[model samples]
Target: MTTRHQLALGACTVTVAALTSTLLVTPDGATAATGPDRIHDIQGDHRISPYAGDSVADVPGIVTGVRTEGSAGFWMQDPRGDDSPATSEGVFVFTDAKPPVQPGDEVRVSGQVSEYVPGGADSGNQSVTQLTDPTVDVRSSDQPLPEARELNAGTVPETYAPQGDPAEDDSIDGLRLRPDRYALDRYESLEGMNVQVEDTRVVGPSSEYDDLWVTVRPDEHPTARGGTLYGSYASQNPGRLKVTSLAPSEEGFPAADVGDQLTGTTAGPLDYDQHGGYHLAARELGTLRDSGPSPERTRPQRDGELAVATYNVENLAPDDDATKYERLAQGVVRNLATPDILALEEVQDDSGAQDDGTVTSERTVGKLIDAISEAGGPRYEWRGIAPRDGQDGGQPGGNIRSGFLFNPERVSFTDRPGGDATTATEVVQRDGQATLSHSPGRITPNDPAWKDSRKPLAGEFRFRSEPVIVVANHFSSKGGDQPLHGSTQPPKRSSEKQRHQQARQVNAFVQDIQDVRRKADVVVLGDLNDFDFSATTSALTENDALRGAAATLPEEERYTYVFQGNSQVLDQTLVSPGVSRFDYDIVHTNAEYADQVSDHDPQVLRFRP
Candidate 1:
């Protein structure tokens, strides 16, 4: 039987000096085979394989797991492995097709050992050691497999990763693995090895992709709803692990929500991929136990209170299924209490994601307004400046932009003329009060910072005879930013630079309004696409111009979105000093649930004028 206990072996006497002297080095610095025949020797103690680019003949191992979908491969582990904790005993043999290998089959494979970076070299992702173009010879079948290594709270380290050497372009590939210190190192050491987590808690809800995230260390930055919190750049919650099934399609993958438990042991080979870094490609999955974590609903606003909310409708279009519209409408009416003014993000053009030149979102907004009305909410009136065709970077030709939905009975939208997609709205003094030059206008739409990004929509509204300036923003996304678990240490947030500039532009616009009237009722809110603690948020709230509502909540309850098992804040509502007292709630009707209307959770702020 192959097992973790049975797989441990005495240290291999083969040293790097011995292998380097005997192996032929290619022009690219990769060693040719003529070295040790074991998997540990091929993996070495570093992130990159020591025997990379080498073609070895007859490497022996027992098949531990097989993945039949999407870059199909099989992981095999040597029952007897070197005792070094830094070196992995198992490796993936990429056949690029369904390999005729089964668990418990002890086989000899001949292939070229290569280091495959998951998302290309420029993505700063760690490389996976694999045997490509393999020829396998199975010796025996139905043998006992190796015992899986248990990954629990006590095993994973608190630290995420070690600092990369600056000279090596901040790449950790050349660094020696320190499994005792870093969580990444520990995962790397066990790459492709049979691993298991017993009674693990689901931190991220199962997606349509048939994968979910779990946490072995339940106490690590736990959210109120049983999620791992990604509080800062420093604390990435090392216990989180993505789980995917290697079982046949008919066996079915579990659809889990946050706080649910995967009862019993879910065991498989630990694999690395581009999506969520290291994950367990489980051959045997645990039973999912319902823990009763449900979507949240906020208290309705009082009669005198003005409620403002922001929801990224996740590219809402008129042609979407009726259920999607109904669900979103229920979230707005029931979960969010149908706020007096709702700022909508990603409201696509009438044609949705189709590559047509449609820029107006009247039908898109009309469908949502109709849904809200059908859900027994107010007949909401909307205002927005549609972007030029394909200028705003979202689904191409979708012309996704930020817009406002105001309950006409409760609030009134000041409709000054001349607002358009490309024109910039200016703050002006009108009768000793701050007012937008063009109501429902865009804020610096033509600025270079807003190039290929969603331009901020600034609108003037009147709630209870008091003027409120609300800037609805859906800033540039963090698409190009390196992953938190990427090879680069302290992973670079390159996408933040443009967001910072956008923040500054919006802040300046807000400052200009405040300059006209010191105590202006200004509210900047929407999907900022950055965290509350980020520099982009700081830039908006700089000089005390606005206070982030998320920052005021308890640390455990601040998150409005969950990504890669970590609860985080991507949407926010920042209020100005003029709005003295307010209550904010991140209504989690989505994000945390398996059935979601949007990827983001809508946030509401209630205040009396």
Candidate 2:
């Protein structure tokens, strides 16, 4: 959850090796060029400049915006408009801190046109057109900055794909963006242009980077959780735009969550680069107001049924001070309504990221248990078999693993013979009752499918005298996969193959018991790292005897994680056919908030075993 994709935007060293032949500069840093060096010509229709790598003498324009902080630079625009949608008139003039130019100053800048990819080139991101290593002479000051281009209804269409061939060869990157046809193209057309969106609704919460995603008027894809819901591949809400604050250090902008609306207007230069598509680099940000959606806590536990919850507490460790542990415990007690049994993933060893080969997490879970008790919740007794020292692919030496935290007063671990982390568990029938031969054992831990990933931990439990077995899982993550907006159409989920194998293994284990006792009341729950509609999820419940708990909610509401502007499902609770789920909810305190404790939201399932 703490991992950020931001790249390092180091200031490039100045080199005048590509100065244009016609360029001439006086000792006073004043330079002038007549033709070809105009701002529009430098910023050609394509992303790469026609004069890229060539230092021009006098690129004349009016400074539209001045960035005084962090790799300080100023933006300039051609006073005369360019009619072509593909051609951008505004361009960034990169320089050292606090350039002499101010907004609304018409100046003649001498610089090299460069394709500077913000963050870094290794980030697998697109490049932003900019003029770098600049020397500017202010021709005039206090001139009107270009008008803020307005975006309203129908300007940005609802379609994600432009009308064309949807193959790799016909990707959006290759096409001459048609602003009138697709929303992405519309923003691409206005790249670096001063733009404004009135009365925008903040769909994504502001992150530590002080950036948030917003949707302009006429987009109805907003979710109750304050994200733009992509219903299908075609339901792309073009009104959605990311906003990066230029004034984050400014006080009084209380933290904004999902469903909060920014009133008035946000005017700034339209920017397109890495960091998940087009955004408005707003200079004049609007006021943020609460949009009425609030944090949600699951219902209180009821009699005759036990509540089970699953959460991946993002590499939680004991040394994280007391704040993180306390917040998580409070989230469980309040947001999760104190589930009787909690399945946790990514529980790092007591040493956390330290590589001292400490593979036990007793201190980690114990601290959380103490916090829970301090928060007025029942004391939870946790159990797990520490994985082989460095086998798990999580934090090295930390040996991240999945485990169970149950209210011992309401539930008790049913320990049988033969339990260890290395050996696989077998299904054995004892006195006509279906049970794991090795209670609280690892499921196929040595299997190649679990190589470097958390092996599923199986444990048999007695909840109010009803025998039930639950499997805690933390599947392979979806990293290193192609992005949806990448050149590849529909993108490839390379991580799904391992997750599918893991799912099949779990499904086979569940099927083993269902063959003998069709109503065994077994439950499989945790961070599966795949959506409910994914093939991995299909393989998990392929047997008619089991079903996913999220299926009970409306299809649009079956989400446990949010990405970009889309709310998705990654965590799940699957129960046997006879174990009907009376109540199922995804606690919404996390995932949609910037101050979230976990990237994946906790799911609570209530059922009678």
Candidate 3:
């Protein structure tokens, strides 16, 4: 990945105007469909096999009935003579997560057509597919999709509600709707192939959710089920398809309305009961859109070469920590020396667990990008958040997270373990509870929270097609003291061992990465909070899985963190044997200035393999 740094920060902002009703042909020169162009008419007895790329003409409907309450989805009915038709007496499912309209409300909706088989033995009845957008025509009595579906069985609790209320008589509350599904008729499919699909819908809460759906497709369908067809978008949403119908076209599938189109397929939620068991499936995908063009930049000086740096932004408080900690004003002091990738420790998130409040990590990265541009460095983007939740024991505050700051212009995220870019990295770096013992004594594991003590954060990214795994860490520090057995004070060994255990965890993580991606071009860099010669460093370096950057440093210049009259190489940069020959070496190898900014110095290594 490429990184840049500029010393100036700009407040300039740009927003694109919304698209008008006139259809602007997409870049591929195709007319965009509106609500009216997509809905189709169907008879009750039609057997809706669910075509992923199927389309229907738009039609006006009234809230005929709703199935369940608390869970929002609906059933619709065509108004008779358009005079505020009464809500239907029969029940149905409304597909949109957002409630469309109340009973008596008149609206035009476009979605695929499907038949509802009321009773067990395939009672053939046809129904209008789910509404995918709110921009559809809504007259006085008409509204957009109404009510959000919280869950079918209640594992996830609903958090927010639609902007307005449905008609008092609207009964389309709990009609269990199947997210339309699709099946690609081919194997080894690429982007633009004409594929066939059945009963699949495309929808997600956010762009990130959609991106995760795209990337995790392969892993979700690792096997063939009864020789059924395989395709992408199968594993995007798990568990429920409260999602509605699919609109297929010779062009491709339609998804969330961005100014631009993203080509993906539609698929129904996995059929739990009919399929006998819940199995991952994929279908209803459409042709591809140009993957958004990569942001352009002057390629870094040497295309294949990488400049790697690691920083320990000591106690970097999140935005909500305190006004004084709102350090966006500082520019990119720590990461000013831009490299293709910057591994940082003590990075705080902008929001706490459950979007509780402002976590500083996002803001920190934003400021870093600003600083990079100001310093005249290449523009960079970031990916992945460390899996840290600041809610330590109901402390009620957002927690700082560790993570990677990458230049999207230079690299793109390829693989993210577990496809969870929202949470901290669990498989790579961990923050678990740990007991404290300052001296050489073992922690008694007394407190329940000890097992969940501070853990390191780690993630990986690709730089110029080369894997660069950055690990940001904040190990157990010697702060809180635990009382000794029947004694008023804890021996120093107790805390030391606690920190030692933290180091051991770091050591094992490095070993584990090597064990899997054996040839991984790994950079185990972070704020270790222990000296170069300390037990922590020893634990990591002794594993043969890691070699410290200090080994590549000149004598008298390896220290990165300094204390009052006490200088130690607490912060270190390390490389694995995979990239050992990259000619790597550290910059800012000494921590001479740790007073104002942080407790450690920022280190960089420039090398070419």
Tens digits of lDDT, candidate 3, 108-180: 4444433332223321111222432223334455443222111221221121111111342211212221122
- Steric overlap count per candidate: 7, 0, 104
Error of 1 at 420 (Å): 0.7
Q: Candidate 2, residue 348: CA error in Å? A: 1.5
Which digits, one per residue and each the tens of the lDDT, describe model 1 over residues 117-179?
988988878889998766566667888888889998788898989998899878788899999
Choose 1 or 3, whichever is better by TM-score: 1
TM-score of each: 0.94, 0.89, 0.40
Q: Output the number of the lDDT-best candidate.
A: 1
In TM-score terms, candidate 3 sits at: 0.40
Model 1 Cα shift for residue 90 (angstroms) = 0.3
* Root-mean-square deviation per candidate: 5.9, 6.3, 26.2
Lowest lDDT 10-mer window, candidate 2? 1-10
Off by over 4 Å in 3: 1-303, 317-336, 351-360, 386-398, 415-453, 480-493, 582-595
